[model samples]
Target: MPRLFQVIGRQEPVATVSMTVYLHATSADYAAVGDDYLLVDSRGARGGRGFYDQHATIWSRDGRLLVTTQQVVWYRVTK
Candidate 1:
């Protein structure tokens, strides 16, 4: 599970546009800070795990992540 993030939603078409992301619900407690693989349909719905070792989705000319993924990693804490 990923613990730290700012899920912004991809709202524009640019080299790197600001994204608008909503918070994952209170399901798991750790989100790995790596690329989380994602899958989207023609309707613009994303489907995939929320955390991973590394994720980098390529973007298409239509402003959709070429693939569904972003970098994320498991949260590590020390006391």
Candidate 2:
């Protein structure tokens, strides 16, 4: 998502060689009135291979699943 990019870009400056892709949304639930939610994200990078991935999930305050996302990123290696 564009918003995600904006947030990430603001937090840290990413290298020009890297790329990010939103793979898919595994689940999503509509929030009801006066409902609170939480966003949890987990990410990992492969050892200097220019490959990275991220998994993000949104959960309701009551611990119910709201949404989940899968993302993959790649970077160009230069000698």
Best by TM-score: 2
lDDT of each prediction vs. the true structure?
Answer: 0.33, 0.48
Off by over 4 Å in 1: 1-58, 70-72
Candidate 2 lDDT at 74 equals 52
Task: Give the range of the ten consecutive residues with the poorest summed lDDT in model 2.
Answer: 10-19
Best by lDDT: 2
Clash-forming residue pairs, model 2: none
Candidate 1 lDDT score at position 47: 23
Q: Give per-residue lDDT, candidate 2, residue 12.
A: 29
Candidate 2 on 4-50: residue-level lDDT in tens? 35434543222433444442334344425145546565555342455
Please give each candidate's TM-score. 0.19, 0.46
lDDT of 1 by residue, 1-79 (tens): 1212323322222121223333442323213323554343322234234322443344333344344444333332221
